[model samples]
Target: MVKLNKKYLKPLKNFYVIGLITFVIWMLFFDAHSWLLHNDLNKDIEALEDEKKYYKNEMKKDKKAIRELSTDEGVEKVARETYYMKKHDEEIYIIEYEDSLLKSKKDE
Candidate 1:
């Protein structure tokens, strides 16, 4: 059975080879912080960074809009469009196009 033993145990004959294999296995699976975990954490960090950038950009846009809306004319425009506010005795009629009505029916 020497031939069978030699075939299975040939790599263990070299101390450096055995040490390298052990180190690789330990780093990949047995360590507290494995290579796979590090890779996944890195991806998570990248995704969080992208989300941070998106939120920063959105915050900047919101700040600009807030600054604009602080003015009287900007407030009036937003009030008229969003709340449909009108002066006393003013009449407001909402008109929807045929295509928009068809689109709304299709959506429903």
Candidate 2:
């Protein structure tokens, strides 16, 4: 019985040490505040990834616009609408929607 007890003591002490270390690590690094911080970081990463995807899509649209604007017809269309300029003897018409003209009316 004495020899058996001695044989188990070393293993028991090792397990105790390991358990204590694990507890300390869990308390310091895996507690509620740590978990909340990790979750926040994950959410922030997801939001940034969404922002990146949005910007990538926007970049694609802008690139398409740039390519189109390289053509003469696209340039003329943008200039005519944006600057309200037309060729000689060309008449420009302004169209306004009654619904959009009043912001409060549209909300109701």
Candidate 3:
């Protein structure tokens, strides 16, 4: 047989204690503004913040490329490498390995 103490059981039997416990349970699990919903919304905010940082970094890289392309030498270099452009007398010989050929085709 277990001995139950009246001191501990008194608070549990009180109306105020019961109402407080029910309120806490309702807010944590059943309310429209529940703890679980707030947690999920916080996770979504973190994911969007990460994406925003990634896009800002990509934008900086694009701005740097735009500045470089504003010069004739940079434009010529990109054209020769990316588009395989050449002067009338200049013949460009591009050697592609097996792996490089596969990657190039994948990019196209």
Candidate 4:
């Protein structure tokens, strides 16, 4: 048989205090909407917010590029740099160093 000492049972004698303790325990662990669940949800919200911020920054950069590309000079510069394009009279020579060549393959 288990014994309930007077010191231990004193707080349990208060119905309101016992209820408050039980409610706290249940809310923290056992409820469908629990403290742990809320914590995980809050973490997910933070990650999504960070991702949203990153995408917003990328969109701003793209918008700036679009504005620049509105000019013929910008269009030719982007084409020459990105697509390795050249005027009919110009010769394009791509020089790849050994260090740059050995920078690990992409399809791992």
Candidate 5:
């Protein structure tokens, strides 16, 4: 009887240890909260990367405008296009978008 008990106890102990290790691993790496946090981190990383790209593009456009405005012609061109500034004899016309008209209709 003693020999039979000893034979079974070793395998049972080993199985318990293996099961505990697997459970610990699952809780750390594959559990619901762990998965949620991992997914959130991925989305945060993607959003930050998109923000970085947007800022890079804005900086590039700003730098190009700066370089152009360092000369007389670029500043004049930007002012005319953006602010409707013109030479003494020139005229300006402003065009409004249809969305603003629709928005006013909805509000009333």
Candidate 6:
């Protein structure tokens, strides 16, 4: 048993070696900029990149819609539907569905 203990504890008896080992362990696991923090920062970067891609696609779609709305007919159609605009002597009826009303009620 004494021989086994001496063999296992021989390396730890050197103060310089023990201090180096402790410093390495502390830097790897307990330092501010450790491996774990790097991994979390990488995940955050990936999530932000995905969000940037999604917003870019949405911006492209919005630009296309805006280009379409530059025409006279598109403007008139959008105005009539979105803002309930009507021509002179024309009556517009807005029909609200029950399901939409129920969904909005549930949201509230």
Evaluated with TM-score, which candidate comes out highest? 1
Q: Whole-model lDDT, candidate 4?
A: 0.92
Best by lDDT: 3
| Candidate 2 residue pairs that clash | none
- lDDT against the true structure, per candidate, is 0.93, 0.88, 0.95, 0.92, 0.88, 0.94
Number of the candidate with higher lDDT, 1 or 3: 3
Segments in model 4 whose C-alpha atoms lie over 4 Å from true places: 1-4, 30-33, 104-108
TM-score per candidate, in order? 0.79, 0.62, 0.79, 0.74, 0.52, 0.71
Ranking by TM-score: 1, 3, 4, 6, 2, 5
Q: Give the clashing pairs for model 1.
A: none
lDDT order of candidates, top first: 3, 6, 1, 4, 5, 2
In angstroms, the error of model 5 at 55 is 1.1
Instruction: State residue 77's C-alpha deviation in candidate 4, in Å.
Output: 1.0
Flag clash pairs in model 6.
Answer: none
Q: Which parts of model 5 are misplaced by more than 4 Å?
A: 1-18, 21-33, 89-108
Please tell me which model should have the higher lDDT, number 5 or number 6.
Answer: 6
Q: Give the clashing pairs for model 3.
A: none
Instruction: Residues 4-97, candidate 6: write the lDDT tens digits.
Output: 9999999999999999999989888899988888889999999999999999999999998899799999899999989999999999998899
lDDT of 1 at 59: 100
Count backbone overlaps in model 2.
0
Which residue pairs does candidate 5 place in steric collision? none
Tens digits of per-residue lDDT, candidate 1, 1-108, equal 999999989889999999999999999987979999999999999999999999999999999989979999999888888899988999888889999999999999
Residue 90 C-alpha lDDT in model 1: 91
lDDT of 3 by residue, 1-108 (tens): 134677678799999999999999999999999999999999999999999999999999999999989999999999999999999999999988999989989999
Error of 5 at 21 (Å): 8.3
Q: Per-residue lDDT tens digits of candidate 2, residues 43-94? A: 9999999999999999999999999899999999998989998999899997
Estimate candidate 3's alpha-carbon lDDT, on a 0 to 1 scale.
0.95
Report the Cα lDDT for residue 38, model 5.
Answer: 86
